[model samples]
Target chain A: MLSVMETSRTHDDREREAALQQLQDIERAQAATWLDHPATPWWWAPYFAVWSGALVLSVGYLPGWGSALGNLALVAASGFLIGYHRRHRGTWPTGDIPRELHRPLWMLLVGAGVVMAAATAIGFLVSVWVSAVVTDVLAGLLVWRYERDYARAAERARRRLP
Target chain B: MSAPPEAGHEAAPAPLADLDPVLTAPKRLAFMAVLASSASTDFSFLRRHLGVSDSDLSKQASALESAGYLTVTKDGRGRGGTTTFKITKEGRRAFERHRDTLRALLG
Candidate 1:
């Protein structure tokens, strides 16, 4: 002869207890997969620095006859390193090499490089300057947008947990 | 003449024994999954990834935090409000035990 309120209260308590227990079980399963590797923040620091330096050099050096060839070389080197990293990690999405290479940011950068090279070949330093300015603005915007998206994704992950 | 004795009927099986009660809830499982994948994550990150409201996350996080399974810390300036979380040693051990128990039960 229990009252309805008492019965509901008992049910709620049991539910929370059960949920907590399940949480523990999941944590254990995940630990088996997660704890093997020690955290390393600097694992890819050298690679990132090298790539960043090359990008800065390619962008900062202005439009000139020789600069186009140098820029092309930079692009080739960057592409090779990116491909090598992806292959070594075995993390490449399933697709042909060309299709797998389709990163929007990378493509935009390459396009800018090509335009700068064209302006240099035609002896239009002014055009090259304009292109550089446009590319810089676009790159900044893209970076800001990506950071926002990453933050949002991280927040969503947190909310999924009890 | 009287009828012959009737055969016995077996009772129905329980629903998968409540799925270990501790490992069956969705949000808790998701939390464990995220923690298992990342070295450490923060409260904001988890909340955004899980798509739960702030209050809801706080409540669930408190339960795990109290159980010694997670460590939570508040940092950053007043406006920024950053809180970080990491799994503790006891938390890892508990998780391992739970996994073994589930495997045994399933078998």
Candidate 2:
């Protein structure tokens, strides 16, 4: 009698565990779907390119008033971008950055930093505006690369699901 | 699951009786789990993710909505119409409880 009860309990446990696993997979698959895009549209790279370049130019070369105005413009553009992303995607990602995206996101930040450092170095040799343009181009390329990496990483995560 | 359980959940598991009844159904549980990860999800997207027919998804969604676990918003009509679902605060709390119960059961 005791063994029979234990066996039944174990069976129930297994069934419950399986159900739990399925629910978890559902959550993860949804997360993967969200991560697949994560607010990045085709023009995301170009928008950041112009925005970052303008920011650099404003801080690096503009007078006080011009820099303030540039900051205002940047804020407005950012707000617009957020609205556009939410409207088009019909979802707002709101959670810790998924582990799958961590590496690519870190690489993007590091690449941006390296490019900015290089741009600053070049500014000393060439014109500041020229450095801004160069930074703009490089930033766009880095963002594009990051987008591809994000897509690949998200795809790998989706493949592993279930 | 895309990830494993974190290590700190190794304590004595809770009893199965603690599970949320509203989340007992597989499709409903999965639906809430998905919603817990996003601010709002569209109806079509939920249907695709849940692999349910439009009517079936609507039925499940309506059940949850009636339970005050989620809110549904509709825009436009017919072909151009869009419906979106957002989990309510109560829903999130319930899901957390259900998930914790599941984790306990696993342990």
Candidate 3:
């Protein structure tokens, strides 16, 4: 009788462990979704491009009222993109960015900074218009790289799930 | 008489007993896991991720809704519609408690 009771308890423990493991797998899968997300691959590029353009206008690449119009365009475009993403993705990721994203995000910041610095130095020697175009390229290249890295990380996580 | 507890002998209630019963179902637990990270999630996304039929997902979601653990918003009807779920403060608290209990038990 005592042995039977022990065996039952052991079985219960095994079941509990399995459930906990499933819970963990579910959490990981969700984390992957959060990392890669639906709008990640294509949505960011246009937004970043507009942002880069806005930055150029703000920094005197374009003179007078053109800068104000650029700013207005940025705001409107951002609003539309955000709304579209919220509808398409069907979720708002309110949590802190995942740890796996740290590398990509850091790379984005560093790459943008380097591009800005180079553009500034070259602007002195070359034309400001050329430097502004370089900034635009910065947004495109950095977004592409970030998406690639994010997809890779998300895939690795999916593979790890049972 | 019962024997004395030995070095390897166990004498404790099951750890699962401490968990919130509302989250015991794997699908429901997984559902909450997804919703907990995001502010809101749609029904189709939950259905695909949980690998459950629409009816099954609906049942489980209704249960959570009934428990006041989540709120469901339905827009329109038929194919063009959307159903979205958002976790409540109560749900988040319960999920956190359940996670803490699981960790304590596993440790």
Predicted complex 3: DockQ = 0.49
Preferred candidate (lDDT higher): 1 or 2: 2
TM-score of 1: 0.37
Please provide, for model 2 over A41-80, each residue's C-alpha lDDT reduced to its tens digit, 9 standing for 90 to 100.
Answer: 6788998889878877887789999999988988999999
- lDDT string for model 1 (A66-125, tens) is 567767887887787766543332222221122212354365466556544643443344
Ranking by DockQ: 3, 2, 1
Candidate 1, B19-81: lDDT as tens digits:
434435566556655565455666655665567988888877787777777887786668666
Clashes of each: 22, 0, 0
Q: After the best TM-score superposition of candidate 2, give how far the Cα of residue A141 lies from its true spot, in angstroms.
A: 1.5
Pick the DockQ winner: 3
Native A-B interface contacts kept, per candidate: 0.12, 0.50, 0.45
The residue-by-residue lDDT of candidate 3 on B1-107, one tens digit each, is 98788666566544667788988787888888788888888887787787899999999998998888899998999999999999999998988787677666665
Compared with the real two-chain complex, what DockQ does model 2 have?
A: 0.38
Regions of model 1 farther than 4 Å from truth: A1-162, B1-25
List model 2 lDDT by residue over B49-105, tens digit each. Answer: 778999999999989998899999998999888898899999999988888777767
